[model samples]
Structures are given as C-alpha cells and as structure tokens.
Target: MRSLEVCKCSKTQAWYLFLVLVVITTLSFTGRVVYLSLGEGYGISLDPSCKPRRHVVFLKTHKTASSTILNILYRYGEARNLTFALPFFDHLGYPQLFKARYVKDFERNPSKEYNIICNHMRFNLPEVRKVMPNQSVYFTILRNPDQVAESSFSYYHDVTPAFREAKSLDRFASRPSTYYSPSAADNHYARNLMWFDLGGDHNAQGDPSYVNSTLQALERAFDLVLLAEYFDESLVLLREALCWPIEDMAYFRLNARLRLSVAPLAPAASSKLRQWNSLDWSLYSRFNRSFWERVARYGAVRMERDVSQLREIRRRLGATCLRGDAPAGAAETVPAEIRPPSFGTAKILGYVLRQDLTGPTRELCTRMVLPESRYLSLLQRKQALIKLPHNMENRL
Candidate 1:
C-alpha cells in the first residue's frame, strides 16, 4: 500500500543545506561571546575557540607557587617569540613601590606594550597599565599566609634583618613584634609580605574597614585571584579562561623543598601566623571561596577530565624528559644546570634530563626544570640579542 518511489533532493538544495549545517556547527563551538568589563578600561571576549589570549600581566607574588606560574608563562611566550617587560634591578625599588620610571629605559623604547609581565613587583595599576595593553588579562595567586610566613622566613632568613638574630623559626614566631618593625627597611619581608607584595598596607592586617577596601580593590583590578592550594585545578580554569591549549599549560611543581626539610606548622603557630597576617589571611580566605565559584562555572566534571589528562601528559613527559624517575628529592638524580639551590637548610630538589635526549626535546626539557633566576638571565641575554639591531631597544 506504501509508495515505492523515493524523492531525492537536488544538488543545489543539498549544497545549501550543507552550508547551513557547517555554519551552525561552527557557531555551536565559537558561539558563546561574553564581554567582561567592570565599568571601565577594556572588555575581554570570553568564548570557545582554538586561539588564545596573548597579552597577560601575572603578578609574581612571594612564595605563592609563583615560580611555577612564571616558568609556564616564560616557556609559552618564548615559543611564540613574544616580548616581556622585565625589571633589571630586582624590580623598580622605590622602597617597595612601583612607578612607570621603574621600567628600565622607559623613556627610550618606541613601543611600550609587552606580551607578558610576570616579574616580581609591587603592583601599581596606573604604572602597570602603561606597560601592557588595555585588553590584557590581569591575574595573581595568593597562598595561605601560614605557609607564606614560613617560606618567607626561611628563604629570606639570611637576607632579612628581622630573621638575623632569631636562632630558630619557633623563636621568630613566638615573638614576631620583638624582631618585626614596620619602619625597619627589610622588616617588610617578615610581616604581611603578601599584602606588601600586592601593594596593600602591611600594617593594616586586622582592621576590617581598611583591609576590606584593599580586598575590594584587588577584586576590581584582577580578572582572577587564584588560590595556590588548588594549583592544578586553577591551571585548568586558567587554560579554559585564556582559550589556551591544554598542552601549553602542562607543568611540574618547582621551588618546592624536600618534605622533611619543611617545618610543619603547629596548629597554634598556624593560628598565630593567621592572626599576625590578618590582611593576607582575609584576602586568601575570600579569594579561595571566589576561586571555587569560578571553577564551578567552568563545570566540575569537565575540569576533572582535563586535570586527569594533564596529569597523564605530565607523567609521559616525565618519562621522556627526566632520568629513570623524577628526582624525588634525591640529590644525585638532578642536573647541575637545574639543580636546587642551597637556600639555607632546605633541600630543594630539581630535575635532570635523559642523557640521550636531543633537539627540541632537549631544549624543552631544559627549560621545564630551569631555575627562575637562571631562566631570567637566559631570557635577558636573548632579549639583548633581539635589541642589538634597534640600538634604542637595548635599555633593558
């Protein structure tokens, strides 16, 4: 009873339908367009695509897993042959203040815009904006002050005058005010170091009224405030936010000490550290909640899948790039070029590549584990070569 003949579409009709399907598919992926601007400066386009946002200003906060982040940015930029606005004098020192004059040879160079700025500096929005583009996405990481206090005390013990007289960390923790003085030049490092690094008032830690404004200012200034505790998860969100390839974001934790070398924070000490650095604590706690909310927007299941894939990629890269296994705190496994520094009593482990590695693999492995100071030096030399032709570009 049914009709036997099948009706077929003409070539023109089929092609037109095909074209419409193609466009719909493309829009489905690159469809979502969101412009994020908090009532000023520039708006960033948030959408799905293969292309990544190139311009960024990453505030390298003290002992906040910042070294790892710096390496990631440097490696990515170098691959793209991008420029960095590096500071020559351990960051423009106006006794812990940032000014446009801090950018070395500021008056000489023709183009002020840079691709990335991840140097250690006291953040000043007006001054920082002069170096980066209006569309640049700004971000920074904050760690629990409890851990920061320990690391700062250990790393700067030999350098900071506050830690000079104290025989032990417990002593320094027991009576911080005895050693810490806001007026003392390097005393800034011993107290509210994170607050100081972000250009917040070091003295005003507990006063909610004052500290809240600082927190709100950061909320306005930065696109994201990452929590160091959730580093891998944060990286996943960062990769999505920037539309960067997941491969570009693969990382190995650097500048971490041997577990035995790290002093465990006695709960009492942690509480006191929190109270003493109340402003930083306030910032960290609030940002942490916000960090989670941001991740939730990115979808938790997809985030876990990406993180799993990332961990596996790292595992394979480790096998290819490193010796039998990653250093694992064993000194002999590390190479001299990438060896951990003898910073005080901490046994900071490093990595060594395979002897047989060569070509791009070797270079990639070398940079993956390179020390921060050494990498900066290498970048400076390369940048010098880049500048030699222009003559005027030699300012940095």
Candidate 2:
C-alpha cells in the first residue's frame, strides 16, 4: 500500500509539472503576440509572413507622393538584400517608354532574378513584363488632378514649356488654352500627366470609351492602385495586398515643397483645373470610389486601426530618424540627403538625420531621410559593386 501511494504521488507531481509547462508556454506565446502588436500593426492579419509576396512593379507617377512610396519600397528591398531591375538611366527610362533594353545589364535569356521593380517608367506593360518575374504584383498611385496640376505647375514651371509664361497656376487656370499647346515640349506635365505616365493618351478628348477601356486594362494588369489623397488607408490595403509586415510600410514624407512658396488653390481654380485636366479628373473620380471600396473589402474598421498604428509608428520613427529643433518650413533646416532637389522656383522640404546615432541604427536613420536621387545613386553603386569580380572588388 505504501508503494502504491508513492507511485500515485509521483504521477500527480508529473501531471502538475506538465500543466505548469503548458501554462508557461501559453503565456510566452501570448507575450510574443502582445509585443508584436505594440510595435507593429494593430488589427493586421495574424500571419503576415505565412506567404509573403516579394516581386512587385510599382509605377512611380510624378507629383503624387510617389517618391515617398518609392522610399518605402527601397528600404524594404534593401533590407532583404533583394535584387532590383534597375534602369540604365536615373529611372527605368522614365517619361520615356520602358523597355528591357532600359534595364541595366539585361540581355537575351538573362539568368539573374529580380524581386522588385519600383522606378519612374512611362509604363509599357509588355516591355515591363520582360524585366520582372511572371508573378510580380503591379501597382501605382494617383492624385487629385487639381492638386497634382498645382504641384506640377509649380515644380515644372521651367521644364514644361506650357507653364513657362503662364507664371502661376491661377493664371494658367484663368486661361489655360492661352498658355497650353499640344505641340509644346514637355506638354505632358501641363496636361493629364498621370494618364500620359500610364501610357494613355493624355490628350484624348471626351472619349468615355477610351477612358473605360484604359481603366479596364489597368484593373486587369495591376493588383492595386493607391490614392495619394487617402495615402494611409491605401497603404493599409497595400500591406494586405502584398502580405508585407508593418515595419516594411513605414515611411517619411519625401519631396514636400515648402508651403510658404505655394498658394492655396481657390475653389474655382480647383474646378477649372479639373475641367482642364478632364481625363485625369475622370480617372481620379472613378478610382477614388473604387479605391475606397477596396479599403472596405480589407475592412475599413480594421484599416482605420492599422492606419492609426501606422501613424504612431511613423511618429516614433520620425523622432528616432530626424534631428529636432529644426524649422519646419525652412530650406536650410535639413540636410541634402533628406531634401529633394529644388524644382523651378519651389523650396522643396528635406530632413536632417539624427547626429548621435551610429552603426545599423545610423544607417536606418540616414536612409529614412535619403533623397530619391541619392538613394538611386547609392543603390546603383551597390549594384555595380555586387557585379564586380570578387578578387577585383578591393579596387572599387
């Protein structure tokens, strides 16, 4: 009977130990989930990495906060050390038709694989397809035509011959045809730039058939179309579409022209601007609704939660990556690395990185503020070094 009691006691102790182990394991798992929630996205799908989508084709449209999105892509791809279908020029033949020939070091039956293709290219889907993988996710951003035109007019005043003598957006909006000419050089900037950039006829006049066909084509070809106005919500949906982690989506505003230099678009001016850029207006109006519907599919309530979390993360990152006590509106306030090149007569905003950081933290902070031009240059240099003979790398 003593032996029987001793054996029963041993069994009871073993059961208690197993129960304790189960409790500890459960707590540890719950703790990890909690920790991730605090730093990453709230209300995001539990398993972001279950099946991550890496290959992407982001059409970088101009004056639509596309630069900021590019920065996000650049950081994510760079972090993973993923290969890029880098263009021979600054971009993959931007403002010109994208071709496989535009991709640097690309040849017939090239063996190297690319994971990301985010650059300014006058998108030609077939030509673009030859560069990236078959499974690459396609996406782009669009902005309100009035706002985009206002920005483009301000930035491209000199480059766009149409805006040269117009002097101001209001003046151009007052009598647009007086200044705008189809025959003018860089006339695309003065017209339906987004449509032109997407390989559509920017000059198409009141053809709903053409517009509908183009929209359908875009719908079929691209996985997502982000709106610059609803940028945060778009980003949340993008996170869902790409199955990207919250950290990969964080970004700082890039290429902001100082507000002091820009005037508010009057209601009438806005209307006139939209009327003048009818094709872009139509595209924006159609897609804005569709984009919202896409957000709803992703769950607007959850999207709101994620957006709030994303903002919080951006705020925290801003504090970490940028120097404080700098004037918000001054051109000289931030360093060149963060600042985009000034356009025409606009005072474009930039940022200064934190001075006290070093090592990986330092690199992260610096890159957060790096300009698109410098980032491209840096990326290209890295790529060049990568292609060099291992024995000859020291000479580089």
Candidate 3:
C-alpha cells in the first residue's frame, strides 16, 4: 500500500506545492494528496484535532451577501452527506412567520434531526427549535441599510409597491413619505428589510427602549452575526466558532448584480436611506461594533493572517473551477440550467465551469457556483431519494 505523510516545508517549497495542487485540480487529475498537515508556516489548518461542526442554522437574510454565505453552507453540508431542513419550495414560507411545518420533512417526520437549516425565512425561534438540534449553532449576516435598500429597489422594482411608485432609489430616499406607506403591499422591502427578515417590525419607530430591547433579543437568538462589509473577517471568526478547516469556508459570490444595475446613492440620499430604514440601521450599527470586538478577542494579527490564507485559497479555487481563470469568473453566456432566477429588473450573474473538468473536480466546482434555486432543487431530490422506500428504489 502506498502511504503519504505531511512534513514541515520551507515557504518556497510550500508555494511550489500549492501551485502544483492548483494545476492538478484544474486538469481534473485523479492523483490524490493523501495528507498535508501544514501548520502556521503554510497557513492552512487552525485545529486539525477539532471535529468539524455538523449541526448548523444559518439565517438567510436578503441582499446582504447572504446568498454567497448560503452557497458556502450548501457546499459544506452536501459534501458531508448531511441532511438539510429544506423548505417545501424555495424558502420556508417567507414573508410569513416560520413554523415547523414550513420544512418539507417536518410534516412527514417531526422527530427527524436536520444537520443544517440555511433557507430564507422570517425567523421564529420556537419553530426553528423544533426542527434543528439543541446544539445547533445559529448565525446570520447583515449589511448596511443603505446598500440593502439600493439593492432591493433595483431587484424588486416591479414586485415591491413602494419601489415601483418611487421609480428611483434616490427619489424614494428624498421623499420616502410620498412613496412609502405602512399599509402598502410588500412594503417591507422598501424599508428596514433586514430587520423585517429577522422577524422584527419593519414599520416600528426607533424608540430608544424598543430598539435596545430588540437588539438584546437578537443577541440571545444568534451565536454569531456577520457583517457583509466585513465578510472575510466574518468568515475567519466563523471558522473559529465551528472549528472548521479554512477550505470548507471558501466560496464563489452568488446572486451578485451586474455593475451597471447597481444605482449608487448620493451621500445625502444614503443618509436619507438610513433614516428611512432606521430600525435596520440601528440593528446594523449595534452588531457592527460587536463584530469588531469579537475580532479583537480573536487577535488582530491572527485574524488578518487567516483571512489572507482564505483569500489565497479562494483565488486558487477560482483558477481551477471557473472559466477565464479570473478570481470571479463571469459566465460568458449564462446557461439556462444555472441562470439565476430573475427578480424584477436586476440581472443576477452566474458562472461557467471549464469544459475539461471531470468527475469529483467537476462536482466540487459546479457546486461552488451553482445558483441557489438549482442547488435547492438538487437537494430536494437528493433528500427525497434518501427517504424513498428500499423496494421502490430497486425498481427505479
């Protein structure tokens, strides 16, 4: 039997080996590197002895880089053959308070313990608790309210009543009162959308006591809250929390809008946007501070090093998995199978895998950039097969 072992190597040797790995991955070579336990010198593993956390609940927020994080969860869970608590359709009865029944398997098997829950939903803690294990770690992501509003307006221009009435993000921000009404249909997307997604009242006044209490409640609900602007740092902290290897967290950005589609908010408009979404603004501001504090506790130098290592791995993966060998490979002509589901006017981008990729390489690369809708469908089918009757399976 052939045996391979890891040994300490110089920086130059490590870099050369990394290049070789990238080439092998790109060519879809079957030759495997049995093991390489690179310590701090090569910047790979944080704690090899620690078991990777399996049970997790990721609250999928909208327009805050949440899709990218969701892709990470998808790859991680699927690779391990772990069960996901998926919704009946795309989301868990989103826009309504989530219940245990919103999960596909819950009605069929209430006692089933899901290894993951990362679907979009209006979070309801009690209902979530019914599906996920007691030890499941819960986390979510947040973005600046200004950015969220701009992205939402562009993405939901036709679907959202306020966005359609205002016609432009700036116009909506300038005199939101004219376009926005609490009674308007789908108005949650117009203001404090992040807050609303977290099961908070989008139309609530930002009274000091109320906002403080809401923040306090959130503090208890989630194990970690990631900020979109500081996504890399967030991942570093996440890796630590879950005791996961760095490569497990690598991802390709999904559901990203084309540059031209993004409508930039003027400084004054940005301020007005924040004001219009005061509840979300308050939520973001409070957590943004705590995120930094958490990083400080993790050590600034160590955090920076891990983040850099993660970026390098991401770059290498992009070269191997995506077309054009760019860090973010844009699909030349978006394929129908993988094309992102269109929402109003925003044209979300997808990716193309290199033609030569085969076997496991192709599978890994494909999942890395698969559109969320397609991935969800694939998972649904996979879970259904798992639950299928054994005699019925033989017929198929």
Candidate 4:
C-alpha cells in the first residue's frame, strides 16, 4: 500500500512539471518570454521585442505624487548618463510660462537634445518640443481636485496671498471669491491650480464648450495621463508604454506630509472645494476614466500581476536601502543636508539609508531618497563636469 501511494505522488509531480513547461512554451510562442524560478513559484512575463524608451517628458504637476515620479526619472537618467533639460535653478521658469530659453545654457546649445525634462513647469508644448527630441513621449499626472486643494492650502498657506488671508482651508472654501483674486500674487495656488499648472487659465469659468475644447487639446498633447489615486496601476501601464523593466519604476514616496499636519476637510468644505476648482474637477474626472480604460486595455489580470511584482520589487529594495518606517526620523535618521526644506505648515519628510551601505550600493540607495533640491544640485554639478573636457574640468 505504501509503495502504491509513493508511485501516485511521483506521477502527480511529474504531470504538474510537464504542464508548467507546456504553458511556458505556449506563452513563448505568443511573443512573451516567461522566466520561472523552480521551487520558488516566482515568474515574470515580458515582451522580448520591446525596446526601452529613452526620450521622455514628464510634466511634473504639484502635490500629486509628482515628487516620487521625479525621483524615479532622476535615477533612471543619472544611471544611464542621459542629458537633462535642467533649469538655471531648481525648476524651469515656473509660475511664468515655460520657454526653451528658460533651460540653463540652452542659448549656448540651441539644438542640444535632452533625454528627459521632468521638472516643475507651466506646460507649453511648442516650447517643450524645442528642448526635447522629436520622438519624446509626453505624459503627466493628475489628482482628485479636493485632495489637491487640501494639500495646496496646507503647503501654500503662507506662500499664497489668498490662503494667507483666509487663515484656514475651511475659511477659504466657505467664501473663496472673497479672498481669491486672479491678479493677486500667488493667487493661482488658491484655485484651479492644476489647470494653471497645465498652462490653462485658472480663472476660466466652467463653460462647457470651452472646457470640452481644452480637454480635447490636452488629450491631443499628452500620450498618457496618469491618475495619482491609482498610482501602482498607473506605473504598470507606464512600464508597458515605456517598455522599461519593472525595477526601473521602483520609487519611495518623497515630500509627503505628516498626518498631523494634514488638515481635515469637513463634508461641506469638500463639496465647496470641488465647486471652487470646477475646471480642475472636470480635468480630473475626464482623465480618471481614461486612466481606467488604459488599465482595461493593458489587461486587468496582467496589470494586477505586474503591479504585484512591482510592489514586491519596491518592498525588497526598500528593505535593503531605506532605514526605519517611511517619513522616518525627521531630524536624527537623515543627514541635515539631504533633509527636505519646510513648506508653509507642511512638514515634508524624507528617508534615511542604512549606515552599513558602501560603494555603488550606498550611492544608489542615497540617490533614491535624496531630496529634490539636493538631487538637482548633484545633477547640475555632474552635468556641468560632463560638458567640460578633463583638461578644463577643474575651472568650474
């Protein structure tokens, strides 16, 4: 009886292994390369013919998980030694419309092509085309208007005149027109900020004809518009579109506010926020549907699997690179140099890497968590050095 049981188990194991091989062969024939780890049950399906895209233009919108996306871009470009269309300072001439000349040294090399342009800028397609290559893939991110308004009110409370005068988000929401003025300095932050960032007039009324035309224009301009609400799923589609390895999309959330600092919007205030930022509301509502449609086309099951894989990749890297819980040790854990600067009442937090890391591993881990300002400075220096020959490199 024991011998009979052992024989049955052996046959079942052999049949399972044979079925696995058959499935893999079928998938391979269908243009997917499946990599399987024996005994681990881990596998990845990738399109072998897809070449990694290099030229990309990420319109870095404010307070919509754009900081995290920028960090990913910074890492990818730096690792590959690609040229960036950097601004003279931290960002391209923002608050003012983006112009080709706004890029540092763009005048000296009018025809120089940059591989990536992921910075805070007022979107201008023609001006952007002047800086990037002809085949660049353009994309941007969006967030729900209510959350954006809440975050903006907190972060720009003191910076924008309207928010400063209103004193609180609730006060501002209750009677927005009373405090908000289109002509006032930094008033853009107080309403329809996302629309303004996208180079649309923040003060535009919610005219159906005008809004529809503007939305259609944006659709024509951007290849993909990601939703911040479905960030992981968005990255899945992004990876497929860019043909990048899932690992390349690994990111740690940066410039996140502490929960205590985040103001709670009452139900009434939340409704008012949507009404006040109606244009931004329409923009978000439109792209949100498109974003899901993209996921459906990408294959819901495939997307779920890829997102799971991405999360695993991020988890492993986070374990290896980051120290403590995220938004960890605001003062003691991270070096003072890499700590993010405070914005209004928003207490932006950063990461701390394990002390034992050294050499290239340490460098990679450090860049993954470096604050935007510090990373920008580092890239500026590196690019500057690259531009100069070895003989004249020291002159700077």
Candidate 2, 97: how far from true, in Å?
A: 1.9
lDDT of 3 at 239: 88
Model 2 score (lDDT):
0.77
Flag clash pairs in model 1: none
Please, what's the RMSD in Å of model 4?
15.6
Q: lDDT tens digits, residues 237-302, model 3?
A: 998888877777778788897777787889999988777789998999999999999999999898
Residues 30-67, model 1: lDDT tens digits: 10111011111221233654468899999889889999
Write down the TM-score of every candidate. 0.83, 0.85, 0.86, 0.87
> Which RMSD values do the candidates have, in order?
14.7, 13.3, 10.6, 15.6
Question: Weakest 10 consecutive residues, lDDT, candidate 2?
Answer: 26-35
Cα lDDT of candidate 1 equals 0.73
Candidate 4 lDDT over residue span 214-275, tens digit each: 99999998999998888898888888778876777777888888788887899999999889
Model 2: colliding residue pairs:
none
**C-alpha lDDT score of every prediction, in listed order:** 0.73, 0.77, 0.80, 0.81
